[model samples]
Target chain A: MNEKIRHLREQMKRLNLEGMIVSNPISIRYLTNIQAEGTLLITRKENIFITYAMYMEDVNSTLTINDEVIVVDIKNISKDEFENFFLFCENVGFEEGYVTYAEYKKIYQRYKVNNLVETEGIVEKQRIIKDNIEIENIKKACEITDNCFSHLLTFIKKDMTEKQVANEIERYFKENEADGLAFETVVAFGENSSKPHWIPSDRKINSGEPILIDMGCKYNGYCSDMTRTIFLGCILEEYKPYYDAVLKNEILSLDQIKDGVVVKKATEIIDENLKRNNINLIHALGHGVGMEIHEAPIIHTNVESYFKENMVIAIEPAVYFPSNYGIRIEDTVVVTKNGCIPLTKSDKNYIVI
Target chain B: MNEKIRHLREQMKRLNLEGMIVSNPISIRYLTNIQAEGTLLITRKENIFITYAMYMEDVNSTLTINDEVIVVDIKNISKDEFENFFLFCENVGFEEGYVTYAEYKKIYQRYKVNNLVETEGIVEKQRIIKDNIEIENIKKACEITDNCFSHLLTFIKKDMTEKQVANEIERYFKENEADGLAFETVVAFGENSSKPHWIPSDRKINSGEPILIDMGCKYNGYCSDMTRTIFLGCILEEYKPYYDAVLKNEILSLDQIKDGVVVKKATEIIDENLKRNNINLIHALGHGVGMEIHEAPIIHTNVESYFKENMVIAIEPAVYFPSNYGIRIEDTVVVTKNGCIPLTKSDKNYIVI
Candidate 1:
């Protein structure tokens, strides 16, 4: 049996749960090496995997499972899959706020589940504290990202359309052996940069305006996220003040990041700096980065969570002047006991393109 | 003023729906120029959208919607965005099976939604029959796919990993200005071709095996789905019967297809021929191809629907022989009153790679 399955059993025991159902794909991947696409139900006595036709092959080919872990395909099974599941579990701890009425109806009609508690953060809380294997993969993903950036920079000159630059980045991503782009590559230029999460358009890059390139790459299944902002032509003296504030704030927030640091507190620091500059940082200060580009330990104003060792995150704070200009600097990092180490090796110097 | 939104409004009025909540992004995009990264609620009275930060900017910039279409930032709106959505909607006809319990709580709680109806084929029923603009883009996407195939064939001669071939297709997709590969380009050679959805492995291609290349391109937001199986070097004479049967079935099905033709009925003919060869088809006969590759009007056994006029679909019937080889011939076609018009003009011939 995998250690994760045993660890989860302990969690179930502590919560007074007879069983727990794991449906979220990421959580399933985390618990079992079963790359099989499906849900895994962990009971006090037995652990079961519900799958379609495809995931069966994946489990057989890749995963190492204990004999006790049962595998059932919904196709070959009866409607009793849900009924049988509930019958087995008495005091069940489910994912908090993750189930639907439709799902509830099927289960409710099937079994008399008395103890259904919403235990949302248990697995995610564990995930935020990464093992050594996760850190190595994430670091490798970052290295791939950096290499892609280095190759892409040589091609991103003045007058390149946002789409063209995006194309180049994607091209380099594959050539450099990335699984794929972690997310849609954002290559906003000039005034367009004002819109955070702007899709790469065909707008031409012009002198005197800043260009923002936010991109990431997926290595294996783990993802790396990075964003860099640079201005074209001469670096404007007036822009530097706002840019410096953003940079100093990003570095300062990252500096505060360490194991046991509260996420809300980190946001307060960024908020205080942004307040000093009379800017509203509408987004969260930072967010955990891992298999999914955005994951657990969301560092914001209200999240009741703290950082932990081996947890990777992207600390990005931006000052946007809507329809005018915007500046943001971001990096991938891991929380250490003392502080954090930058996973992204891309240079963050303010420069002219 | 877009026609799709107008059409949806008519649907809402007929359903006595005060409003319709669209959770599928592609469906939202089909109706409104606005693609919902999160969800879009459309009432007979008004339209609203809730999406993440990234796509909201793009849609807001491009779409011209009525003032009342409230676009909410889902990340900021609720405790958990998916659960929050259920809370936001009232008396809504959800895209029933599409939404999970994780997504229904908030809107479901907020609304007196006893009138919750399962909208079986709302967007898909509409999307199955595309308009002029959609057809033009799908045609263009197919052309791009065809050209990439022709170009790659000119250069590929052996001694390349499956990854390299996949990369080459991606490069050609970019070089010819495709949005991106519609899905990860599948390049399987020899025995790897046996698995229908084989992810490109690092294995080198060997001679004397049937090669399968299933690829597509997304031009604009519309996509093209296609699959082409080719024989490398010379093949045994016995294999020709299977190849002929596959091609004959595709041609016969294309001839028999017309508006109002039962989808599975089309597959029944192929299934009968497949039985003659003692082969069981693993997947559905075909699927409606549109903005999304696998849309609606699934052509398979137990499908209780029929193809309608203007409905575009990819009719692919494959025969899989484990550990040896397989043959699949696919093409995109438009359902019409008389019979069918083949949209993807790429001829499936015995290409000796």
Candidate 2:
């Protein structure tokens, strides 16, 4: 957290601003170890965590921070609070992209404030590269994730619904060793597999339909994301080609994920790979996988961001048939000088089991 | 949703509000069935939903609303757009609790508006009572939760870490027929259970210690919450008194949960019971549970809200021994005219498997 605070302070120096208003809860949590749904007002001079709820006890018990962290309660928020805080800054920078017009009024009118600038994505930009601890946690999370999936394969039967499979995965995560799931387990079977963000349903896994499972686990606050699609029964010889295409594309993207490469180029390779197989690829090529599943340096074949060394990202090569089925192969990876290391260790080969 | 809207309209009438501005995402989702992170401006003359993101597409796919849900892009928000929509509203009400000061400024300044009044708990009031469908979903969610816990009991072992057990419960929910767990799976072992909201850790379960597991499942869109603390090994005679105190408190609360009893009174009963036993309870008795794990009509001894029939509330009787050990038993229940229907069926038995 101290390191994060230092990073923000350096950002303030670069922007020639005295302070920044961090409203995004995720960013606040990452920076302060406080996970409450609240806003953070940070400046070069001081930092105040504001909340309407009484979080004092929670802060004292759970949130360990340096003396630099100050807790503030919203009680008739006075203009003096903003001015006193902002006086240290030449300009007040806000995460403008996340805040709304209504939010602006409360701060400006109530505080009689002025000189606010939009400085979005700076924290996220820094978050793209994982620290050693963060990477280790991610790896541990992935290890738990892989073990859970392996157990699921053994526990799963044909009679179970997609929801059941999802639940089993969740239970396995807890039983194996995971703080919790990084996100909602996506267990889509047959037609449901077509929806990229399909919520698990009660529909049972049938004999001939394709099943796609996208899941992640959080270990020590870091997260790992992985996705694998398989068929309940014997895979048709024709579908194997598409499966092979996705696997090859994922491996190809992993091989290409070295330092100093444009993110677009990697996505383009996967895109061309899918196109070669005449599959309609949907969604982005991949995304950064860390404390947050989808972070920065997005691999979309057109993003301006470039892959840098030590940046952990997911490479998901998918082919969707809206009314029929969808197949996606995703693996979390850390960008290296030469290539990348896959975080999740699931055998992506078309499993007959 | 119509009933909810009508209920809120009646609240508006009572509060002398002609319209309301709901910026809280949960409130908006509850009112319109539009699961979009945006604002919903409700007036007698006009209703509008505004957002900067392409939530319209998401809403269209996710929700089936009766009224014509308006879509407002952030780029097009002007004074005319804000004022014209609320032209007929003599007193426009706003969710002051949720609308941040900064957002308030952006709206007030951009719209050149000054007529909106702070409307407190208008939508929250309607969300208290459980409808038939909501109750139905809650029941299914609870059933799934119960089944998951039962499966968990079958596989209980001494050496498994808290993380692994937590993972198993989550997986069970997804596989059995659930959207996901309602909240983080709390699998606190032994002394770790001392923290009421303990994050699952990599601690091994030891014999003779209380294994406290608080977990829930989300089915459909509704949620179920339940908690059970059990002796992992042999029962300690010294701990039986503490265990019995918590158990008796829950049973008494359940017996008293009839139509028209003040919810706070029920909470006070437990507090008094614990006090009589020389125990100082630190947290609230329970809370209203539904679409959200914690909702309106909090079961806190200090609160003034009364219990009503058909309200789904969580009854949690917990005894926290700070820094040493703790035990809590919680179950989601629906208050009935005669008594209450227990939604969660996870056995809160004192004995271990």
State each model's CA lDDT, in order: 0.78, 0.79
Tell me the TM-score of candidate 2's A chain.
Answer: 0.91
TM-score of every candidate's chain A: 0.91, 0.91
lDDT of 1 at B338: 84
Q: lDDT, candidate 2, residue A201?
A: 74
Off by over 4 Å in 1: A52-54, A65-68, A73-82, A93-117, A206-209, A231-234, A351-353, B1-3, B9-16, B36-39, B48-91, B112-114
RMSD of 1: 3.8
Interface RMSD of each: 3.5, 5.3
In model 1 chain B, which range of ten residues has the least summed lDDT?
B81-90
Per-residue lDDT tens digits for candidate 2, residues B39-122, read 787767556777755456776666456555566776687667666766656787877667755566565665444476777667
lDDT of 1 by residue, B1-353 (tens): 56887777677667766566677777877777665466777654556677777666666876665434566676676455444344444456877556666566555664445566667667777787889889899989989998888887776677778888888888788768788778877888888888888899888877777778899989988888888888667766766888888888888888878877777677787788888876688988788888888878788877867778888889887888887778888888888898778777776867886
What TM-score would chain B receive for each of the candidates shown? Answer: 0.87, 0.92
Residue B238 in model 1: lDDT = 65
| Candidate 1 per-residue C-alpha lDDT over A235-353 given as tens digits, one digit per residue, 9 for 90 to 100 | 77878888889988888877888888887887787799889997799788878888789888788889867777788999989989888888888899999998889999898888775
Best by TM-score: 1
